[model samples]
Target: MTGWWCASRVPKWARAPIPRWRNWWPRGGSQGVRSSQDYVRKAGAAARMMLVNAAAARWKVPATECTVERGVITHGPSRRRLRYGEVAAEAARLQPPQDIPLRDPKDWKIAGKSMHRLDIPDKVMGRPVFGVDVALPGMLHASIAQCPVFGGKLKSVDASVAEKMRGVKKVVREGDFVAVVADSWWRADQALQKLRIEWDAGANGNVSSETIAAMLRDGLADPKLPQARKVGPNIPRPTSTTPPWSRRPARPG
Candidate 1:
């Protein structure tokens, strides 16, 4: 939307009442979305684009005559123009359009092109701010601690000392994970360190490095056994050769 309005020369005032609706992502979404291929937008985004075109119609120009770009909305070859920010209030007052023109591949311009992304400039300047950077009034910080040993269950936790510590707001334990909420991140970390926790190692208590090496040695000698990288508990040891991939230094985070 910013790109479209900017090309149209939309003034600051014309941008009023834009984003009056919440931009909410629904649950059940992929939490880790780092690449462009993982991107997903809701149906509301489509409706918002329709509203942009509908706003132009309210100004006596049909969508076909108007070109919205860089916050500006222009009409006709002579390029008679109105900024989107100028029409924002009136646009908010108008009813939403029932339908929008379905975009044809022929109409595509910027999307999927090799052109520079909108956020590149800010990112290059180290000035980009993300959602996680937002700070609300009286908002607290949290620190989480997870069990280091997999398959181990949290047996007990004593939080009385943590609760009495200064700046410690709350300590929460759910399943094997412990969360510390405090006035600041440092305080939360302090509280987390103070927590006295015990874990039930169960069958894992018997597992050891020597045992793992022995299992690895056995796994390599067996011919019919399926090849695998990890030698988890309960897998019968077949040979001693260490996995080739383990020879490399650990990958940095």
Candidate 2:
């Protein structure tokens, strides 16, 4: 006699449901759903903006000339069709938003469904053209130096050795900041490395975190501090007995 045995292959995770039948909600739960709703509500707006911006990367289309409808993008007159995904790819390479009149809602299509963002690939690939990513011919690198203390005045700076450094273009000193300009960041940094700046430090120089805490505590301790609220006509007027500076003087006498 032969005995029959059944064999089955089971997944390692099949032994139990995740959370052991706790009926846990999916990740992103309510908040995720809300955020997603917000994203959808704004999707058309984002697409409307991106369509024209992306169009310029390829051809001249006014922002009002292009729109996203049903995941496809249409440019004005030509009715040329593109996927939002495609537009997003093109837009990731484009400059920051410049006004192109946007298509109004009455003229829209493709904006309502939950679809993935068009710029995802560029962001994932680290190829997004952000402000810091812009490159122009003859562009120079710049870094700012400022007084470490508030309201400090720059005394003087010695740039003799710094001026001699290779690749140093110019040292620009504005009221509160000094910019070391050069052909390249490394060179600018090198140029600044040789300079020394002095400033007239202000009152906060000797102030520490501990002293600030004490001051805050003392301010809070003064009951008058709360009554001194600057907002609205409800502010309590100072009485004659109050400090001279706190009360308006009676007359010139």
Clashes of each: 27, 3
User: What is the alpha-carbon RMSD of candidate 2 to the true structure?
Assistant: 21.1
Q: List ranges where model 2 is wrong by over 4 Å.
A: 1-114, 223-253
Per-candidate TM equals 0.46, 0.46
**What is the lDDT of every predicted structure here?**
0.62, 0.59
Candidate 2 C-alpha lDDT tens digits along 66-170: 654455666768878776556666765654343434446574443344655666888899987776667799999876678887777677788888778888899
Pairs clashing within candidate 2: 69-109, 69-110, 70-110
Question: Which window of 10 residues has the lowest lDDT sum in candidate 2?
Answer: 1-10
* Residue 166's lDDT in candidate 1: 88
lDDT of 1 by residue, 61-178 (tens): 6667776666666776656777666676666566544453344546656455566557778888877666556679999988888776657777888988888988998998877778
